[model samples]
Target: MDGRLIYLMGPSGSGKDSLIQAAREPLQALGCEVVRRVITRSAESVGEDAEGVSPAEFELRREEGGFSLSWRANGLAYGIPVEIDQWLRKGRHVLVNGSRGHLPVALERYPELVPVLLTVKDEVLRERLLRRGRESPEEIEARIRRNGLFVGDGSIGDRLIHRLDNSDDLAVTVNNLLSLLKLSVKPDQI
Candidate 1:
C-alpha cells in the first residue's frame, strides 16, 4: 500500500496544534501517524514534540541530508527527519505540521502530499494570539497581517487543498479533519 502524506499548514493561533493533539490517538488507531518535527528553537519555547538544535547544527544536518524536508520561517529553521520516507515506504499514512510557504517544495519532494489549510476568523485569531502570551502585541499584529496574505491570495488553485475553519467548536473542526482523512471517530471517542 503506497502511503499518503498529509501536510498541515495554518496561520499562527489557528488551532493547528490543538486539532493535531486531539486527533492523534484516533488517527493512530486508523493506522495513521502524525510526524514530529525538528526545530532550531528551544524545546521550552514551543509546545510541540520537537528535537531542538542550534542554528549551526541545523545547517550541518541540512547539509548532511539528514532531513527529508527543511525550511526557514519567522527566523527559525524547521526540518522533517528523513526517517519519514522510510515510514512512507512501509505504507504508513503520515501527517505533518508544516509551513505554508514550504508547501510547494514539499509537494515537489513528495508527490503524494495532501495539503490542508486550517483557518480561523480574524476576531478569533486576535483573541487566540493574545491568550497565547508568547509574542509581543506588535508581533501578534504582524502575524495577523501575514496571515492575510495567505488567506486572501487565491494562489492555492488546482492543488488539493483542504481548508477547515476552526473559529467555532474544536470538535467540529477535528471531525472535519477526520472525515477528510477518511478516518471516522465516534462523538464521545474524540
Candidate 2:
C-alpha cells in the first residue's frame, strides 16, 4: 500500500482541532485523508469532529476489537475505528488526531507512520486553555502540568518527530504542516 498514516498529537488547547480542519483541503489535494476520532467526551463538549460514547461502551468496543487503536488519557478514552486499516491498505494517506501516550503502540503498528507533534508556548497554552473554558482553573493548571512533560517523558524522541509551534498565526502553522507533509500549496488556497 502506498498510503501513509500521519499521527497528530499535542497538548490540550494547542489548537489541534483548528489545525486539522485548516489542513484538510490542502492535504486532501495531495491525496491525504483526515479522520475524526472516537472520543469518550461528548461532541457538545468540544469542537473536535468526534463521536462520543460512554466509558462502558468504549470498553465494550475495545474488548470486541472494534478499534484499530485506542488509548485513555485524563479520564477519557479515545479510539481510531478499524475502518482506517482498510483505508490505509487501500493506499489512502490517512491522518488521525491521536494521543501522545499511545505513540509507541501506533509506531509499532504502522512503521511508516509519521508523528506530527504540535506545541505552543507555555503562556499561550495557559491562555488558550483558559479561553476554551472546558475545564476549571484547577483542572487547567493540572492540564498545563501534564503538558510540561509531553515533550521529554522519554517514551519518544525528536529524531522521527516533526514538531511545529502553533503559538502564532494558524495560517503560518498550517503552511508549515503542509510543507512538512511535502504537499504543494494550491495557489487558490494561499
Candidate 3:
C-alpha cells in the first residue's frame, strides 16, 4: 500500500508552523514524516523549520529536478525535495505545509492525497499576524481578505478536504489533526 500525502494548507498566520512543531512527536509516533520544506529565505528567519537557500541555489535545484513539488508564494519560492516519493513508496505517511493555490497541481500528481485546510477565525488570524510582525498592516489586511475569499469561494468543494479549526487552543487543533490522521490512513499503517 502506498502512503498518503497529507497536504496541509492555510493562509498566513493560521499557526501552521506552531501546530507542526507541537504535533511533531505525536505525528512521528503515528508513523507520519513531517517534511521540512526548502525555502528561498534566510535560515535566521523566525518562521517554520524550513531549509533556507539562496534564490540562485533554489533555481538551480528546481532546474535540476531536485524537487518533486515546487511553488512560489508570498514573494518567495518553496520546494519539496524529491525524497518524499521514496518515503511514500516505502509506505511512510508524509505531511507537507502546502499552498492552497497549488492544490490542483498537487491533486493531479497525487490523486489520493489527503488535503487538509487549517483555518482560524478572522479576528484570531488578524491578531496572530500582527503579533508575528512580519508584514505591514496593509499586507496583513490583504492576507485576511484573501483568506476570506478562499474560504468562501467554494473551491474546496466535496473533494475530501478535511478542515481543522485552530481558533481557540493549539492543543485542540493538534489532537484534531491526529484524530483525522488516524481516520484517514489504514489502521495497520498507523
Candidate 4:
C-alpha cells in the first residue's frame, strides 16, 4: 500500500515546530518519516530543522525539479524535496510542515493527504508571538488578526481538516497529533 502524507499547517505561533520536534521519535517508531524542508533562510535561524539555502540556490533547485512541492510564504521560499515521493511509494508515512495558502495545490497533487490545522487561542498566540520577539507588537497584532480571519473564513475548507489545539501543554498537542496520524494512516502498519 502507498503511504499517506500528513500535511500540517498553522498560524505563525501555533507551535508546529515544537510539536514536530517532540513527536519525531514516536512517529519514527510507527514508521513515519517527518520531512525536513528546504528554506530560503540562514541555517543559524531559530526555527524548524530546515535546510537553509540562498535565493539563487533555491531557484536553481526549483527550476531543476528537485522539489515535489514548493511555495513562497512570509517572504521566504520553502520546498519539499522530491524524495518524499519515493518515501511514500515505499509505504513510509510522511509528514510535512505545509502552507495553508498552498493547500489547494497540495490536495490536487495528493488528494488522499491528511490535512491538519494547528490552532491556538488568541491570547495564547499573542503571548507566544511576543516571546519570539521577531515581530513588533503591531505586526503581531496584524498576524493575530489574519489568523482569526483565516479560521473564520472557511478558506482552508472543512473537508477532512483535522484541528489540533496547542493552547496548553506541548505533550498534549503531540499526543493529539500522534493519535490523529495513527487513525488517518494505515493502522495495521502502526
Best prediction by lDDT: 3
| TM-scores for the candidates | 0.90, 0.89, 0.95, 0.95
Runs of candidate 2 with Cα error greater than 4 angstroms are 153-159, 183-190
Off by over 4 Å in 4: 153-158
Give the alpha carbon lDDT tens digit for every residue of 1-190 in model 4. Answer: 3988899998999999999999999999988999999999986684889999999999999999999999999899999999999999999989999999899999989888988999999999999999989999999999899778656533455566888999999998999999998888766767
Error of 2 at 169 (Å): 0.5
- Candidate 3 matches the true fold with a TM-score of 0.95
Candidate 1 C-alpha lDDT tens digits along 117-151: 99888889989999979989899889888878776
lDDT (C-alpha, whole model) for all candidates: 0.84, 0.84, 0.91, 0.90
Model 3 agreement with the true structure over 82-125: per-residue lDDT tens digits: 99999999999999999998999998898889999999999999
The residue-level lDDT of candidate 3 at 126 comes to 97
- Measured with C-alpha atoms, the lDDT of residue 8 in candidate 2 is 90
> Candidate 1, which ten residues in sequence have the lowest lDDT sum?
181-190
Cα deviation at 75, candidate 4, in Å, is 1.1
* TM-score for predicted model 1 compared with the true structure: 0.90
TM-score of 4: 0.95
Worst 10 residues of 3 by lDDT: 149-158
Clash pairs (backbone) in predicted model 4: none
The TM-score ranking, best first, is 3, 4, 1, 2
lDDT comparison, 1 vs 3, better candidate: 3
Candidate 3 vs candidate 4, TM-score winner: 3
